[model samples]
Target chain A: MQVPAPFDYKRASTLAEAIALLRECGPDSRVIAGGHSLLPMMKLRLARPEVLIDINHLSELDYIKVDGNTLKIGAMVRHVTLQKSHLAAEYYPIFAEAEEQIADPLVRNRGTVGGSLCQADPAEDLSAVFSALKADILIAGSYGTRKLPISEFHTGPYTTALNPDEILTEIDVPLRSNTGSAYEKVERRVGDWAIAAVGTMVRVDDGLISEAGIGLTAVRADHFRAKEAEDSLLGRSPSTEAIAEAASLAARHCNPFADQRGPEDYKRHLVEELAKRALSRALNRSLPEVH
Target chain B: MRVNMSVNGVEVSDEIEPRLLLVHFLRENLRLTGTHWGCDTSNCGTCTVLMDGMPVKSCTVLAAMASGSQITTVEGLGANGELDPVQQGFIEMHGLQCGFCTSGMMLSARWLLDHNPNPSEKEIREAISGQICRCTGYENIVRSIKWAAAHSQNSGVQQGVEA
Candidate 1:
């Protein structure tokens, strides 16, 4: 019984054509890649764009490759591709681990990585995974291309730093040699959104943790991360006490809202517990002896 | 807008609205009601179909996006009036009680067996996790997929298109 409001549709053969369509259609327009996230919202009357520019044919933007030291992932890369990228898994196991837990196989087959990131749903798994990896986003506009750190990409839930004429073309994940990342999530059912989840990347040298990145989702973590917690981990030994302190700090700062998922206290507890588990797994991955 | 796509291996062209969902286009426009409509939110896989040989929820995809793609619906599962191994497996394993989720489940199983000739019970379960059988018929569904996986080699008429 649900359907989108009547709108004009244009399929963009190239990125330039897509940008021009966006500009010509004005701000009332939206470009759809996979349309998994956008279409559902369109049906609910939550998003009412006057024009829809389809960018599915832009194959130039669908790729996963290594460019120097960064693993460059195209915006048009589908979720299934991201999940199966052995190159990405070699660099960051978090990519495959998180992709497996996002939605379902059918949904993932059509959902593009760019569409998921652009949708900017607070509970989306990849956003947290990207935040944990400190990935950079590339945006293209009529003027030219500009780069923004993924930290500054999401302005708020369901919103981003993208202008009307801008399109996210690629994501740059800096590959590290001695680093490991993992994601831990707890959902009520199969393919459901996380009630509370944590993604962390740890770079350990000798016995000291050189860098730590902790990203939380659904618990309302600021910028989808626990900066205070990550800061506490700087140059600290990968000891149980150090990890527990960071985990506790991560759980303390997050402000979770209650819904059918659970109460706030339960989510906060999950943040702390899941953070501890993910951090432990990442730390172990970084150190082969204990792994 | 006018859309042209191969449906069940048939070349079909139709004039349709841009907002039309693939599920509606298949059912109302093409009269391919074998692809059911359930939980329009796209969470339920009742409207699942193969796009370029991969399973996708048709409700979430715009018909415009499927213009150049090859779509295989439930009606296309069998070849030359013979049931696909998946369909036969469904019957052999008693996969359906209410049969509401059968079409989508069978299509997903067909896709799985096409890519992976033999899938374990866990893999079969994962392939159809997006679908919901209100009848709670998962046990039989898993058995049905395993049957298809076992029978896939013997019965090779190919899937999707006859061509």
Candidate 2:
């Protein structure tokens, strides 16, 4: 067994303290919320920080609140909570469906949404879902706080745009519009990491496509929008041919890697199939009259 | 750090490293070895234990974070040197050949029954998907969970198995 390197451990009772510690420790201290991703990386020697500042004890950061126009989820909210939340099921049911398909119940119970995003494993399922949902990440720093769109937050594989002195505090997702969203994934086996996953959110107005956002995961270095596919569907009533064409375009945009799961070309093919299926489902549910 | 939590109905307060996983705290510090550690990667639920009545992989949970929480290991279920109904059901159903994954299977089953009393086969399969038992091929373990869920409560001390 590979043990983690020796590190200083600190507990923060408040978000202010956590941010302050991040500023003070700079590059050495890592904020640990659930440790579902970071701890495993630490054990594998992929990450070896000088300090582990635990934010799990900060009870103030564990809540799921539905404000007037947005649903705000604290950074420490576990994936299981999001999966089982009635609010998520009512407002953002697609996220619930995606959460249900994550690693498994044990990882879901301990993994936090913010940590998953911050870890920025490009192939992360929830990251793509949130990116397609137009979620905002609330980050706290020594200066104050700032929010960034999920699209702009994740920079690359295992990297985020967050400054070393910044810590993510909450994830704010907008309430659904006259829209329907769907998440579809292709994995090597049940309960295994996804080879490629697609999350499509479509907003329809009077049998016409008003807006569309498509996010792809595991097929690229980072979760990215399939703007070409979205562009193809805009202002048109989606048909089988159009959806298939858009999916093919999405396939062309992916940068999949040949891994133990599948070949890069196969992963690209999966993205196309998954994107087509997900977009069609979203279109059907969002614009039933047109379908 | 000084940590305080209840394990197996006993309140424990001890000093521990913040990076120490709850499984190590329970097994090494508290000397509760019933909770096995199969894969520390959190892939296998062998280190599963009930934290605040919810089943979680102890290897992923920090001992410091578990402070002030209520934990129940596999040892907490039995009574008077006997096996719990779930444990006995595994024995009766031949759920184990090597017995390495028994504790995780039992705790997972216990948590499943607590949330869902009469689970469908799909739900049962989903509940224990986190646990991996290479010994029994999981057929008998599923059957054992079903049997324990069906017969244990309604039987009311019918001389089948005592816990």
Candidate 3:
């Protein structure tokens, strides 16, 4: 009985073709690739467009390549691909870890990195990983392509800066040498959305933290970098006391609501637990010889 | 929409509604009832199938998206009438009770073995984490996958190591 809303379907061979279709369909079109996120929404009647622009066949967009000092993940790269790619595991371990943790294996085989971001769900695991990695998202629209920092992409819960005509092209994650990153999530059950999630990336130089970034999800409108917590840990060793205090600061800064997953108190507790665990794991992996 | 694809090793094409799901196409159009539709949502892997040798949730994929791809359903799993090794393992290990989740479970296990071949117990669990089965408690299912993984590795499939 599950069926998508009636819509004309078209397969686009290239970005230009896709954009042309989008432009032609105007506001009644929706682009779907690896519909782990979008298809379910459509079946649930939450999203019903008159045209479905199928872009999964655009094989050019399904790639993971090293470009200079950053790793470029194609927008169509499925979650399963990210989880299994050795390139991703080496360069962006946190993202790979988080990608593996998203949904189940079946969904991963069909869900995509771009769809997760474009969906802009506050509880999505990959969104927090993108924020913590400070990745750049490439957007291709009818006009031209533009890059936006991950932090600026998601403006609110279920909302993004992407225009209706624009399609997410790729994600660029910087290759951090001698850095450790970890993604820890607290969910109601395995393969479920995170009730509250934390992504921690730390670069430790000679036992001292050099650069640090923290991303939180499900506690705010969208995944956001915890600037206050990052500031507190930037120049310090990840001592248990220091990490605890930093995590507390993160918990304080987040504005979480009482959702079906848990209440605000429980969610705040999850932040502390996840933040502490993620920071410690990242720090442990950041040792010069860990790689 | 008109879709033409190889389903269960058979070349077929049919006129379908634009909203028809790949699961429905396989079940209703091809009459491959072995592919059961469990939870229509992407959460349950009851209608899992291999699209170009990769396992995908059939419930979530539109039939229109599968115009040129190769689809392998549970009915296409075994060679001839013999049970596939993964299916055999499930039977020997008593992996199913009610059997509602069997097709998806077997397909997921095949995907895991074809890719990993020798997965650890944790990996086996994680591989089929998307599949939900309320019967047989999953202990036997995980055991069956682990059993098949060990035997499949010995059967000559290469196990790629993760760095």
Candidates 1 and 2, the one with greater lDDT = 1
Highest TM-score model number: 1
Residue-level lDDT of model 3, residues A1-291, one tens digit each, is 877778898889998899999999998899999887778888889989899999998888999999899899999998888988998888667977787678877788788889889999888888888888889999999999999999889988778999889999999988877788999987777778889989998888777888888999889833577788888997787699889988998888898999788899998898988999999889888885654
DockQ (CA atoms), all models: 0.83, 0.53, 0.78
Native contacts conserved, per model:
0.94, 0.40, 0.96
Q: Residue by residue across B35-130, what tens digits does model 1's lDDT show?
A: 999999988899999999999999999998899889999999888889998999999999998888889999999988888776777888889999
* lDDT of model 3 at position A12: 98
At residue B135, candidate 1 shows an lDDT of 77
Model 3 sits at a Cα RMSD from the real structure of 2.9
Give candidate 2's whole-model lDDT.
0.84
lDDT of 2 by residue, A1-291 (tens): 535667788888898888888888879889998788888899888999998888887888889998888989998999999899997767656788788888888778878988988998877888888877878999988888899998899888889988888888889988766788889987765568898899888888776788888888888834477878778888887688878988998889878889899898899889899988898888777754656
Q: Estimated TM-score per prediction?
A: 0.97, 0.94, 0.94
Give the best candidate by DockQ.
Answer: 1
Is model 3 an incorrect, acceptable, medium or high docking prediction? medium
lDDT of 3 at A149: 96
Better of 1 and 3 by lDDT: 1
Which stretch of 10 consecutive residues in model 3 chain B shows the poorest summed lDDT? Answer: B154-163
Off by more than 4 A, model 2: A221-223, A288-291, B80-82, B154-163
